[model samples]
Target: MSDTSPPKPVLFRSYYRDWIEVYKKNAVRNVTLRKYLLTLSWVERLAPDLRLSELTRLDYQKLLNDFASEHERQTTMDFHHNIKGAILDAVEEGLLEKDPTRKAIIKGREPKSRKTKYLNHFELHKLLESLELSSTPSWDWLILLIAKTGMRFSEAIALTPKDFDFSKQTLSINKTLDYKTRTGFLPTKNKASIRKIQLDWQVLMQFSELTKPIEEDELIFGSLGKIFNSTANHNLERRCKKAGISVISMHGLRHTHASILLFAGVSIASVARRLGHASMTTTQKTYLHVIQELESKDIDLVMRAMSSLN
Candidate 1:
């Protein structure tokens, strides 16, 4: 019998929804899934009726230009890549004659200049001294740990009493909290992020006393319950004000930790490992200014040593 059914028209939004359901949802983490959904929302807004066969390069460029108008260049790139992945998949499925996103120019406003998000050694010491850690677990404890360990907020929040090895003075980071999903014990950001951080004697003693009364499996900071990043930053800002130090976000403590270590002549590789960065490249890119400053000091030291030898 001859086929007589009409072919279903594939709208851009519909195909993207299907692609996300079948390929992206299970493959990505909840945080990543949320990002994909956000990008899909943009696609829906700009090209609701755009058919797969009718989507020209001009239409796709218009979408990118529209999104880039409000976002930073890096963000716009991420948005472009997300949509392009699905569009390429559609092409492979013979839904389109050619890719519409090819050679699309990225456009965006210039990023605003911002001050460094780390504290100096003296400022950090002042901030630490301000915290009252007398056998009680609070956000102060969390801040202290992050400042010393350079752990990500998610990794630090997910920690339990059992994660601390007092005898060995090591803290294991094998899991992360999914704040977006309000779930506990998700995998770390990357394989490299799963590491054991060595702890100072003082920190170990403080944590030992703090964790003594808590259950082995209970989170050190207890349940935060849907706390937003801005809220956390605001709290940290208050702490900084109380400490009489310049205000910095919670993540700034991580940066401060790494910066202090690098300034103290720690190897880039060791700093990268301690920070749980996926690669040295990531650490380098994040603290390029610090690295450049350190290079200048190294040049001066080399010249002094050479002159002294003569």
Candidate 2:
């Protein structure tokens, strides 16, 4: 007589790998793909024996609690989002009875103190004055470009003489350098990132003279060789200390540019385009504090204008 036995249930980790291979592997950028792979590693580590068919809301909560114990709240939220996508698909495929992630509570460790993210007008002026921009391209030049144009480091480093239009005083942002992998050129961060940013006369003239000797297509800052974001941050930190301003990261230069524009009463839409943000929502969300402060000033102006009408 032949005996029949039940098939072993599929491991949740295995299902997640299949989900990533089918849904995420080729559908996202290499940097984004690596994030999914990282989520997979965490799944394997945290739920090694969890079966797809046995996933429950309780089980999912426990897994998140475990993850949260090691990370900050924002990081925990990102991790939850990454895994939730796969879990939802698994449910639709009839591999699970229901979504285990619904109503799941996200918790995490306390966030550490953050560094100052931007400089004010006077602080920025001092920082710029501290930079020593010489005839040759240097990190200081890169710092100044970001401070002026709000360009991402990758976008600024990928720039060449051909990207600049001196007559129009605009710079084309079409690609970004793959500084992390040393893989040459890559597409911009998003479709919106491919844009033309107008340059002020001073910056246009400075760059025109600077790029005169370099090849039209050669990387503006690539001569530095295998530059990392940290390299730029160190240079910026030195300048900040020398100028006696608050220390900020390389990314802070971006924040500084955006903040200055917003404070100067430039329209949010215009600043959003200059920053190459995918949406004005991103810009508004990132600078909500600045917006609120500006709104208060607007209210004061409104009151004064109304009183004058009497």
Candidate 3:
């Protein structure tokens, strides 16, 4: 017997949108909304073909497995991990009877290196050397801001003139750029991200001299009061490649700042506050391996010296 079935119809489930709206409305930081939005992108792509009534935990598991096969472990873990949070939210909102992502756990996602992958002092020098001759002031100054203050690219991009408090020696972070949204500044990732970071004299001096009649509503690095130049990230990457350095992502610069500070003996709590981590716990997790590695080296050195005495 021949069976004929029509292609399944695609539908945009309101339940997905509902959860997004709920998250956006009540989330502690716009960053939560942004993350949920990213996960929902995958759900949106897959959800259309899915019959809401028939969808089960097994379906999402298969989706995650498919993602794992297509990407490396870390990326796949991020994909499922992020979406699982959304599903958990659904459970909270009474949209689901049972959580589909109940046990979508990650095992080997911990930081693996003590080196804290960032451009070293030499690479930093090279990067600055490359930026010095830019046709625009924003280009060079933006790089300086990151190197000096260690602001995340998104956080830096979202900075408005108001965020810079010269009299107080503080920079307040409220928002950052989210690529998937293709929009203006959205709330940062967590409550702790909305922090006030104090600046060193060098950073303050450079900023004071850099902005000429800074407008309150204007973004710091933007030209003509725009949020960003749009091509900034790609252009910077291309510039790095031309400068004969391996093209590390702009985000790497942020990590580079933290690694340098940690190597210089800055306390983890200070680093967390400066970097706007939601919790010291998050900061610790990120650098725990680095601390362990440093501890091991110190122990080895001590053992060597003791043996010499013996």
Name the top lDDT candidate. Answer: 2
Q: Give a tens-digit lDDT track for model 1, residues 1-310.
A: 9989998887989989989999998788888998999999988888788888888999899889889888988899999999899999888988888999889898887997765599999999998988876667776788899998999998998899999999999999999987766766799999999999999999998899989998999888875556566777887888899988889988899999999999999999999999888999999999998999999999999999999998
**lDDT string, candidate 2, 1-310, tens digits:** 8768888789999988998999998788788889889988998999899988999999999999999999998888999999999999888888888999999999999989999999999999999999898998999999999999999988999999999999999999999988898878999999999999999999899999989999998988868877999989999999999999999988999999999999999999999999999999999999998999999999999999999999
Candidate 2 at residue 247, lDDT? 98
The predicted structure with the larger lDDT, 2 or 3, is: 2
How far residue 103's Cα lies from its native spot in candidate 2, in Å, is: 2.1
- The CA lDDT at 224 in model 1 is 52
lDDT to native, each model: 0.89, 0.93, 0.69
TM-score per model over all chains: 0.91, 0.96, 0.71
Q: Which runs of model 2 end up more than 4 angstroms from their true locations?
A: 1-4
Better of 2 and 3 by TM-score: 2
lDDT at residue 74 of model 3 (Cα atoms) = 79
Q: What is the lDDT of residue 140 in candidate 2?
A: 92
Per-residue error (Å), model 3, residue 298: 2.3
Candidate 3 ranges beyond 4 A from true positions: 1-18, 21-60, 81-100, 105-117, 133-136, 160-162, 165-169, 177-185, 224-230, 238-243, 287-289, 304-310
Task: Provide the lowest-lDDT 10-residue window in model 2.
Answer: 1-10
Candidate 3 or 1, higher lDDT: 1
* Global Cα lDDT for candidate 2: 0.93
TM-score of 2: 0.96
